[model samples]
Target chain A: MSTVRVVCQQLAPRLGETEHNRNLGARAINDAAMLGAQVVVLPELMQSGYVFKDRQEAFELSEALDGPTLSLWKSLAAELDIIIVGGFCERLDDGQVANSAALVEPEGRLTVYRKAHLWNREKLIFTPGTAPPPVVQTAVGRIAMVICYDLELPEWVRLPALAGAELLCAPVNWPDAPRPASERPGEIVRVQANAAVNRMFIAACDRHGEERGIDWVGGSVIVDADGYPQAGGNAHRHEQRLVADLPLAQARDKYISAHNHVHQDRRPGLYLPSP
Target chain B: MSTVRVVCQQLAPRLGETEHNRNLGARAINDAAMLGAQVVVLPELMQSGYVFKDRQEAFELSEALDGPTLSLWKSLAAELDIIIVGGFCERLDDGQVANSAALVEPEGRLTVYRKAHLWNREKLIFTPGTAPPPVVQTAVGRIAMVICYDLELPEWVRLPALAGAELLCAPVNWPDAPRPASERPGEIVRVQANAAVNRMFIAACDRHGEERGIDWVGGSVIVDADGYPQAGGNAHRHEQRLVADLPLAQARDKYISAHNHVHQDRRPGLYLPSP
Candidate 1:
């Protein structure tokens, strides 16, 4: 009965409102900690907001690792004795910027992962990361971080899962699109599939509200190792808080059947490195 | 608009009832062709049924490429001017048996793919395949084939999708599992996610009815490039037929957004060959 209380705060951040967004993030973290959450996740680009007009604007909003937002998060994490995971626009060398997420532990340790697979206009706005998603061994459980479209690539997800990540926390801003009525959004469906295939838990925090005429799906979800939604598997078009207690132990046992172990059953020899 | 009508006939096959199962398959294929289907898919092990009593029993039911089942399918495919994809127990040298599927095109070209990933009890009963799933360039469109459990591996599915398979026709036997009410089965969700990530069309046919006290999910589904079900996305407990006219041209255009093409967007270099 080893469980971890996870929280995803689906918030709306105004574009370029760094100070306000930092406050919003602090409030969400405090609320989650009060509810006994051991790990709290926030949406992608919470510091500067998504839907940037151009690379120049994103660079203007980007923050360094020592910047106020991450500094505040690091302090809060240590003060609350909880782990915090959230996205921010990262300031890079030569006036470059990257979409990055930071995982701050209560012990003042930090691990950062830049978005590897850039979504739509993000190609023009940020430099894609060359390193794989980072899987950190935290006190609560082994956790990993990836951003938005990175979840779409199962190959990318497999890296961390094989590396012994029990829970994958993603910060996403899923844009709204027309879908069949009464069907789950494909974004959330993909997340469930990713979790199930690797026998890992996933908590994806998505943002709400429209930014520059782009409304989001607001489809934050937490799926168990079997890929079933533990909480918030719907598209709620408003600020929401999704909380779930995941039996992290279930992820340690990858066997779906007596003969099959998810990771061990894979035949990578047949799969080419790059096709 | 170049469209190809695909049909999935979910039928039950009595174990070791080769003659009866042949008639059942012939009837389903005829029915699909009558419905103007260019391609028809059937469930895994349709020729010999799943839930074998032992390895000896499965070997006894195994057939070669020139066996009556595939021979009949090849004749029917050429005669009816359509493609038929279905599963059977393949007899290998030295009394070995492999769970395999055959894709018979209108030109009488037969492509066989052995199930690389075996399920519970199957590993004891059958020899696992070493070859990857086969993608064939058919007259209707470029199609591929893989059997059940193999579908659970996204890396295996990616092999065909990356090989320019516009549509992947799978023959699956999804054993019934307890799922939350009003939720789509994880098997179907994985199918949708695979299609969406690859921007490829997929039609997976599952069987119905009880076999040796083992019931099935009967979750047959046909998903378009966008990962939305065009037909049969539910778990019906009886024999059923799912049909959809797929404009496979959409699969060729991998771009989901202005900047992201599903295949081109893949950062394969970062993904390890054997992770």
Candidate 2:
């Protein structure tokens, strides 16, 4: 069984500054490579930040999937020989924009996934994505890509898992307000519930530092299939990179030995749809 | 604004001991009434403990809604002149046993709710309840009663709220296992989430003490519509009653204000159901 080294890169980019944001992303990738990581994940909309003043501003930040963003990431993947998952603003040819995440392979091959569950303000800016999520086959393992709010919707994650995705990658930019520090455990509880219920390794990378006058909760975490945090970032501090050696074989064994048994027990026909 | 004194009682019953359980319940009600509690909520299955070895035992212990259990509660309610929520095992005249909860008025009138969601192990003993939950109009306000697992199922709680329930009463007999003492905050998170999302005052009473070799986590709590715990029972102790003045008027006002303005913002049609 090959040991897989994964890194959760918690980077905070200045909102609307494409050049500096891209540079920071590149630096994080380099840092992961230095730590001998086979896979790396970044936060949601790492380039544009979470708050968009208007739809027009969000559209201005959007780039084609094969545009300069991919080109830069492709070069980085080839240079490091590692898999990189990162978020970006995607502009379709028809002028519709989507908050999207992309999985870039070491050889420059890429798989893109648009955000399925849009947040409140995001509904005003980006069009809702209708395409089913993409689960790409990587040298390390099967990987699925998703963006911020997509994680909140179980169907969005469940679909990818059913499609044979062993690892789910989420790039989130959660705003730091409405909930106080005392309620931080509640946030972790939600994340843990998602991991335990799904029985999958969730590598969720959240944005760190202040952006657009709002503080971003920087709890970028790598939760095991059992819903335990392996290694990651914290809510208050800006962590550059968190690297951990993951046992893909153990994860495979866990799924086959226990999760498969649980799946057989699910009475899907009787389940009430989300209300 | 009229003040309402609500008492959230955590009733821990010894499994299979009906007589002792009945005495304990009667004592709690009398104590709460003496303390000036206008409303009191007892834990789920107060007459019979959570775990029943087999259907025979459950049926043997079960009584009709108007049988000895309700009869005892009726006398207590009339004598105390206080509203009481108590849980029981109902033996339907048709020979089926249903986990049930009853809301007893001060004048001895009764409104009962059968458990909607039967959890693990329970499915083997109790039949799934077919009757829709009923919200009775009370002198204090409109109140709805539900058994343990019913609260975990959103529809069980949500339907009653839609039917004009200002307050939700949950009687739970949660087992103390799986979670370590360090994870106490994780337990409270669910209570807060349920209260906040429902936008209705929730009086959740949980059982305490060890019964039939299973330890019950005794953190019976009363949460405001906004998910704040106004009063709570401690995790360490057992067989305790907590009394607090629940401001029903403030909760009603908040719910109405949010409904009139934010009702249009709820895009239920777009939101996916959570698993």
Candidate 3:
């Protein structure tokens, strides 16, 4: 068993700055690769900005899998022998657009995952993802990709977790939520709980700055199977790129103790009956 | 929709002192009823006290549903028009014993829900519960019951939330775990996340104090459907009964925004097919 070094890049992207945002993502990827990260994750809409003006502006910013930004990332992933999971505005056939994330592995395999649960204003511009999130087996671990608001839905993560997803990569632009005083933000609690329940490692990269009256939470976290942060995994109020070694083998141990097994103890028949 | 004032009683029980523990529970119930609480919850194994010595000892501490403690509670429920949910060691026929929570409604209906996932050392003495957690319709709201470790399983809570449970009454005896510095304990995170994910309110009553060299975490919390604590719902260390007004109507608001519905947004085919 080997430890997969995971990096979560908390960077703030400019609105509608496609080329410049791509450069920022590339620099973060390069730095993470230099630091020996096997998997590097970027914030949501890393290639374009969130807070879209209109559908036409969104189309102008969107890119396909083989387009310039993804093509550059694919080449970089192949060259560095690392996997890149980053969010982008996606342009598909017949004027369809989505908030999506592209997963490029070292073996030159690329899979695009769209955001399933659209947030407040994104429903006006991007299409809500229809396909299930993809779980890809790689040298580092079994990885699953989810765009921004997808993390909020339990089924979105629970489904992949049951399918043996070891690592959940989330690219998020979390707007400020009302948090209780002297407590960790609700987003942090949400990730840790989901990670602990499924016995999987979750790496969520959140944007760190304000955009058009929308203030980002700026909290990026990577929680282990026990729902606790590994060293250098919990960061807030800063543009940080932190890496932690995730023990993939431990995630396979859903048995917290001899009697309690996280996954096996689930009464799925009570949740949803089996076919 | 009338408000159901829910009370969580956090207090320590004496080991091997069934009469004393029942008296303590009665006092807490008196306090809660005086405070206008319609539903009062108590900690897990409130009668038997956790950390048993042997099987014979556990049996000595166990009682049937018609036992003295439950009869007292039934009379009190009828007298006060308040519902009581509390944990006790259940002694069944044929020398079988189980860890169970009894829900005594104001109408004299008693439902016993066994502990599904027994913690360490408990598997040695008690029979693990087989039936799914039940959701019961009450005058004030739809209620559900689960023991301590059951809260850790997402399916345990998610099922009832989907079944339209508004208030989840949990009788927990949370032992202290290794917590990171300046961070809320992992137990708090688990409850809040599950509550928010299912769009339901959860009120957990945990025990406070040490018993036979084992220390329990005494933080009792009642969180709203959105996962933030209601006013006066967060109580730590000390023998206290806290009450919060639960908006039962909001738990039915699975609709987070105009487009996103927590339960409706599920892609079950991707998880497991429905029968």
Candidate 4:
């Protein structure tokens, strides 16, 4: 069934400490590699934490796509011979910063995606990227990357699936808002909903531990193509690494058999633009 | 702040038996009245089970809006002095049948909402309703009714909210699907998402119990205006009712304070319809 081991690391990072965050990221990668994970994912804005008091603070944390942070990831990917996906703040030449994710291959090849959907406070610091994310062909399988709020939008996942992605990777830093226990199930439900609707494996990695007085809800999960969660992090815990074997063939089977190919069903003529 | 009590009834019907179903509906109404619920909601297609085998079976189950089903509900609402929201199969003059819900006031006044979004099997038996579900002003509050599939679409809920619906009553008969214990949190999550996004109290009534060998995943919930599930139905049991006292004023406060109005922020000029 072409099973591949994947790990979602719910690593907590100290704010504004790039070097410490890089070390933490490396440690997570090393641990997952030791456990035989072919691919590993980390949370959004891992290097800078999520809460920024101001736009200038967020901009100060931004780095070029090929900057030192990515160079460190490339080295780790090459040393571990594993695929690594993680989030970072991207500083563009035009003086704009964006919430972005990077996918580093074993050969040190890197592909970056800027977050398209910006959440509250994020709009102040990051400019939404215009380009759609591409599903790159990797040695393990075809994978796509999305950042935080982007995962909440259906089109973000759907477009990648349409572009031939078998697996969707999301790195998130979800803020803890006080919610009743009855409302706790929403995260898994949304993941499964996305997985089933797209007919693809989803490795959604979320941040854990409190930083800057804001608690990040870390419940990283690996959802199957059939919308079933295979493994990963849970609420109330942080700094945990979840590893599981995901079958590529089973995902393909589900896509071929059950997916109605909603794209094919699209009657463009009947659709009116939102207004 | 205004306070409103909402009851979401996850009711089940005896397949093909209107009399038995009517009795069950009346009993639930009586119980909700005793609990001091201002608004009581029943599931979609409460008079007949969700699955009716074939078109002929569905045709036989169809009744006019003012037929025996409405008459019974009217009397019950008046006797209890409570607002009752329930679903029925409406037979039109043109011989077309629609999956619909009716809002019956304490004085026996009724406003019917035809199902807008039809599911897979329903499309085979019923024609889509032409008019949008209108929000009806009541003694307790302004209420709106929507059938099962309508809840899945965000616009369906948003339109009513804009039309002055402080409370959204959704009558659903969701089929039981296999879910891991860990995934149980998904129900609460969806409820929270809906409540949070809409900024309105949601009384989601789902059919409970097994009928024709199909299990109904009963997680009927009463979500507060802030998206917190105040009362929830047990998934393992059948024929359960969830009663909760909801404060309408508190909902308005939360919605206004969040300033996260999806409808207001919608860039209608840029978006396309969902496929």
Structure candidate 4, residue pairs in collision: A185-B185, A185-B186, A186-B189, A274-B268, A275-B268
Assess the local accuracy of residue A156 in candidate 2 as a C-alpha lDDT between 0 and 100: 53
List the RMSD of every prediction in angstroms: 1.2, 4.7, 2.9, 3.7
User: What tens-digit string does per-residue lDDT give for candidate 1 at A1-275?
Assistant: 97999999999998988999999999999999999999999999999999899999999999999999999999999999999999999999998999999999999998999999999889998999999888899999999999999999999999999998999999999999999987899999999999999999999999997999999999999999999999999999999999999999789999989889999999887788343
Q: Compute DockQ for each candidate against the true complex.
A: 0.73, 0.15, 0.52, 0.20
Tens digit per residue, CA lDDT, model 4, A50-145? 787877887788788777888888998998899999999888766778889999998878999988767777777788776677688999888999
Q: Reference contacts recovered by each candidate, as fractions?
A: 0.85, 0.01, 0.61, 0.10
Q: Write the per-residue lDDT of candidate 3 for residues B1-275, one digit (tens) a residue.
A: 66889998898988789999999989988888999999999999988788888767889999998898899899889888899999999997777789999999889999889998888788888888887778899888899999999888776777778788999999999887666765566787889888887889999899987888888767688888888777333436678777799878888878877777888776665566222
- Model 3 per-residue lDDT tens digits across residues A29-126: 99999999999999988888898877778988898888888998998999998899999999977787899998999889999898878887787898
Error of 1 at A162 (Å): 0.6
Q: Which ten contiguous residues of candidate 1 chain B have the minimum total lDDT?
A: B266-275
Q: What is the lDDT of residue A230 in candidate 2?
A: 73
Worst ten-residue run, lDDT, model 4 chain B?
A: B254-263
The local distance difference test score of each candidate is 0.94, 0.72, 0.84, 0.75
In model 3, which regions exceed 4 Å deviation? A53-56, A231-238, A273-275, B53-56, B231-238, B273-275
TM-score of each model, in listed order: 0.98, 0.81, 0.91, 0.86
lDDT of 4 at A114: 87
A best-first ranking of the candidates according to their TM-score comes to 1, 3, 4, 2
Return the candidate ranking by DockQ, descending.
1, 3, 4, 2
Question: Would you list the clashing residue pairs of candidate 3?
Answer: none
TM-score of chain A of each: 0.99, 0.91, 0.95, 0.93
lDDT of 2 by residue, A19-135 (tens): 888999999999899989999998888766668887888888888877777789999999989899999988876767888888999887888888866766777788877666777
